[model samples]
Target: MSQETAEPGIEASAKTAEIEALKDTFRNVPGLAGAPMIMAPALAETFATHQHELGVRVHPDLAVKKFIAPFRGPRDAFNPSGDYGAIDTPATPIPVLPNMREYTPHELEVIVGQLRDMGVVNDPEPPRDVAHVVTD
Candidate 1:
């Protein structure tokens, strides 16, 4: 006797559709423009978690570059004033990386806090108290 395999259920199809829709959404979210590699489980998980509102997987390697002249150059990379700011400053090369890892929301918050303390961003405060209390 020959046996026939069962087709996938509606639930599986629906889940697949949902995942596809999420992939589309992930593509549109800014700052997430990177190749999606299936072999990288961490990257895949991270992309899904941050972009799909799903569980987070491993943290992916996100590349970044910063101005090197100010941090490292003797104003040597590019003289914005001298060159009329026409030339772009050279950026620092990639820094040594640690084992790929994931960041919890709490860890992210801590990183953000440290960045703000380092003046990378401004602290959230009441907006200048723009409105006068106007107490008589």
Candidate 2:
């Protein structure tokens, strides 16, 4: 005898449809260009968490180059002006942090704290090391 698999319930179907509709709405929204279409709340949280973590992991040199170099004025004492100073700055080659494994317990706690403040995570405890979560 052959058995048939159970179909999804009405609620499940409705939820899926709602998620799809939300995705479509997000796609048409302005100023959200190139943003990933994440349908699940858990997935979005994970993505945001990772993004913030990576932001914290950015090398100091690269951060300076990208965020500071553009607005930097000329190095002259008077009314010096130009991109010359920015261009003359030596590039520091630093190895990028690959993952959370490189972060210390304190670092993880700080990241978790920031995430909590931004409402990305609701954990009441602080994160300890890479694996441990801080408890009150």
Candidate 3:
């Protein structure tokens, strides 16, 4: 006996339409002129989680070169001064952090405290007292 497969529901069709609309939006962004229309399979889930938490989505197929310069010049890899120094050397690749959620609350607190001690404040306090302006 032959069996017929079920068609996609209304919800699925709506989601597909939304995704297509998003893809069209990404294609039209100024700086992202040539970014891919679809996210990579490996990054799909991670990016979806990011969108869920941050309410923003990044194009997965965006080229790294667009954001970072290629390393092929006489400038020092650690620090560059001018346009020639804009490129980053392979010796000092950008650092990627692991998921912070994996850390225990105590571990996160310790990390934040250490960073704060080292002069890294997430939210700096604003000046309280404002001097009154005198009109001549």
Best by lDDT: 3
Instruction: Give the alpha-carbon lDDT of every model.
Output: 0.44, 0.46, 0.47
Question: Could you arrange the candidates by lDDT from highest to lowest?
Answer: 3, 2, 1
Residues 30-73 of candidate 1: C-alpha lDDT, one tens digit per residue: 23344222223344345554654554222213313212333332
* Residue 121 accuracy (lDDT) in model 3: 60
Per-residue lDDT tens digits for candidate 3, residues 1-136, read: 9987556797577555545434433321233554323334335444444454554534546524222322444332222221212223234443466898999999999999988888886657898998999999
Expressed as tens digits, the lDDT of each residue in 1-136 for candidate 2 is 9987556797577545545433332221222564333234455345444554454222334433221122244322222122222434764333354599889999999999999999999966785667767999
lDDT of 2: 0.46
Clash pairs, candidate 2, are 105-129, 126-134
Error of 3 at 21 (Å): 31
Question: Model 1 has how many clashing residue pairs?
Answer: 0
Choose 2 or 3, whichever is better by lDDT: 3
TM-score of each: 0.23, 0.22, 0.25
Which candidate would rank higher by TM-score, 1 or 2?
1
Mark the 10 consecutive residues where model 3 has the least summed lDDT.
77-86
Q: If the candidates were sorted by their TM-score against the true structure, best first, what order would they fall in?
A: 3, 1, 2
Q: Which is better, 2 or 3, measured by TM-score?
A: 3
